[model samples]
Target: MSSAFLPGFFLGFSLILAIGAQNAFVLRQGLRRQHVFWTCLTCALSDAVLIAVGVAGFGHLAMLAPWLDLAMRLGGAAFLICYGGLALRNAWRGGAALHAGGGDGSTLLATLLSVLTFTWLNPHVYLDTVVLIGSISAQYSDRLAFGLGAVCASFTFFFGLGYGARLLAPFFGRPRAWQVLDGLIGLTMWAIAAKLLVM
Candidate 1:
């Protein structure tokens, strides 16, 4: 269980560490010092809910159809590989950078709505939190521990990103920073995919 927890934590962190609209919004809010806590909490909780659904649903489904476990593993690995390739390609192209300025000055409610939209409406979130994470959790003997680890990672990352945005703003402004981040993300994704394949 303890072993599973650490893997879950690392995997969860790696998956969320990728750059996306949701993360960009959180970073912007953090930099602006606007509804930071609520924004982070909303994103974390949304991930928690989805993670729970995925872990539980997939576990049961795998139980009913034993072959599904292998199928999902293969599918998740394929997805991760494709995603990693894209990240690597982005890294090679090396021109992406965060633009933290020019916020719309939206109200708290509006901001919350926008973040929610970014979270719930994104298909990638479903793929990452639900299908991918869920499928991976099924491989662990202690699925609950794995799920908890993932949940904790989500909370830690969102709060950190939301509160640390100001600190990260300068660092993220450079295209080289984005390239390095993308490179690391690509490597991490491929590593996880390799592990899944070996399992």
Candidate 2:
């Protein structure tokens, strides 16, 4: 169990470290420095919820079903194709042009909606955090430690992206940096989706 913890956390983090819509959104929020806490909080809490659900709901299925991986890969690929297209379009049209009306109320609402968009609409997020990570944990047959590791990893992601971003502020502070980052994320999503589909 103790050994499973490190492997589980590393597994979860490795899958999640890739570029995707959720990471794009979180990076945007971190760079904008607007409602950073709310955005990161929503992301972390949402992942925890989904991780729990996947562990509880699909725990048995992960071990029993062989086609499950195939279905998930295809589903994730389809979703990623769609999401990547939208993200690329957004990058071309400017997805980072957020201005929170210069009021506390507007900031809160905007932040909430932004996080909701990331939480609900991002397919990569669902696939990686909900499906892949959960499935991996379920493979252990004893996910009590793996589940906790996954939870810890989820929080670690938010903190790493939010707080650690301060170090990159000088570089990412530019609009061009956002464009490049968003564009790269979109491209990476497509490439990975294609890889999964082919495999």
lDDT of each: 0.77, 0.69
lDDT of 1 by residue, 1-199 (tens): 5788888888889999976657866766886567899999999999999888888865344356667556656766676677678768978987533234324367889888867866775555767888788989989988888988999999999999999877876775677776676687677667766866887
For this target, which candidate reaches the highest lDDT against the unseen true structure?
A: 1
Give Cα distance to truth, residue 112, candidate 2, Å: 2.2
Off by over 4 Å in 1: 58-104, 168-199
Question: Candidate 2: what lDDT?
Answer: 0.69
Residue-pair clashes, model 2: 0
